[model samples]
Target: MLLQTIFYVAIAAEAMTAALAAGRRKMDWFGVCVLACVTALGGGTMRDTVLGHYPLTWVEDPYLLLICCAAALITIGLARFMEHLRWPFLLLDALGLVVFTILGCDVALEMGQSPIIVIVAGMITGIAGGIMRDVLCNDVPLVFSSELYATVSIVTGVIYFFGLQFGFPGEAVIIAAALIGFALRVAAIVWKLEMPKFVYDKELR
Candidate 1:
């Protein structure tokens, strides 16, 4: 029940953040809702398509679409105040990344996917929506260069999967994994920690 509650909150949070992105682009209200739906649901949609999971998440639960659209509209109404909540949004985004990863792993486990595939699913769920959002917004995708975003996803998934395999209580595993991933993300942001980038100024040898 706790997990499910957090999942709904994360979905709405994702939609709200995506709505803000749409506002930054000066998108019309319709465009704002569209982007919100895509950014909040696109990752799971891609994951379901890849895994042959039928009906997709929003299709399975149409209310999810309503939640996204409603969140987007609320964001549109509160646009000015949102600009001052960058850090809070970042924290929420970090929380969403870990929660989504754990949820994705659970889906893969239900499908009897291999461990690697489970981790991959978690990573996809954590980052792919942001990638799609960036593409639509005409900005470089932050997941490609952001501070330990996908890394946190993978770490959270690993901890989640192994914790279950080791017979830990589900609630304990979820909280531990989420706390670790969230702290890692917050640290990365504060310290500006990033993966090594390959810079190619000249032609390759």
Candidate 2:
């Protein structure tokens, strides 16, 4: 039940982010809906495909599809207001990353995957959607360059795995992992924290 709640919240958050991206691009309603669905469900779809989990969630649950479309439409109506509140959407995106990471870890662990695979799965689930979103929007994916985006997902997975290994209650582990991941993301934004970039200069080479 807790997982379901988190999953829905994550989807909604992702859909809103997608909608905002679409708005920036001045896409039509159909385009907005398409991007919203891709951003909201693309990560889980990739995870399930890799894990051989059949019948994708959106396919099996049409309501989730409806939710994404509805979210996009709502965002369209409030695009002007949302333009001034980008920080809230950024926070929501951070929350979505944690939720997706934990859910992916849970799924991989259930499948008896190794620690490494579980962590990788979590990262994939957390970032794939955003990757697709940026690709469609003609922008570099945030995961590839943004402050601690993918790092937060990996850390969340690690926290969840170790918390369970240490025998923490499941609910406690979930809350702890989410809070820690969200804090790291918020700190990254506030402090301008980032991983060092590798640059290639043709002249130097």
Candidate 3:
């Protein structure tokens, strides 16, 4: 229950950021809300489906839907404050990645998944929603951006994987991962850190 609550709050904040970005693209009010909800929940839905859970978490809990709706409304109303949205979005994204990663790994661990498989599943769940959001928004997603995005997820996932092995409280593992991920993300952004990219060479026809 605690993890779920944290997930909702992180997603809600992320939704607000997404809505602000979507507004600049001229999305209608309804469209904005849709984007927000989709960005917030799309990944978890996919994670649950991949794990063979029917109905998904949000579907089973109407409170999740209600939370999404509330997030959408709040985001739409705050559209004029686009400048301040960036920090919160980045923060939420990092925190969400860590929490989701831990939750995914924890779920897999409970389901008897092997350590390696659990880590992979956790990493996937961490970044899935952001990927969906970026694709839908027609922008280059953060994960694809050469930033420290996926690195954060993988690191946190690994942390959760090992922490659970040592019998750490699941919540503590999650919180530790979240803090690390969030800090790494913020540091990367602040330092303009990114993965090196290769320059594509065009051959003469």
Candidate 2: regions farther than 4 A off: 203-205
Residue-level lDDT tens digits of model 3 in 69-99: 6787887776667576577677776778777
| lDDT by residue for model 2 (7-97), tens | 8977987998899899889899999999999999999899989988768767888899999999989988888898787898888888899
Taking all chains together, each candidate's TM-score versus the true structure is: 0.97, 0.95, 0.89
Q: Which candidate is the best by lDDT?
A: 1
Give the per-residue lDDT of model 1 (tens digit) for 31-110: 99999999889889988999998889999999999999999999988988997989988888888899889999988999
What value of lDDT does candidate 1 attain over all alpha carbons? 0.92
Query: What is the alpha-carbon lDDT for the whole of candidate 2?
Result: 0.91
Q: lDDT of all the models against the reference? A: 0.92, 0.91, 0.77
How do the candidates rank by lDDT, highest first? 1, 2, 3
Rank all candidate structures by their TM-score, best first, as comma-separated numbers: 1, 2, 3
Which of candidates 1 and 3 is the stronger one according to lDDT?
1
- TM for candidate 2 is 0.95
Least accurate 10 contiguous residues by lDDT in model 1:
196-205
Report the C-alpha displacement of residue 126, candidate 2, in angstroms.
Answer: 0.7
User: Which segments of model 1 are wrong by more than 4 Å?
Assistant: none
Candidate 3 steric clashes? 0
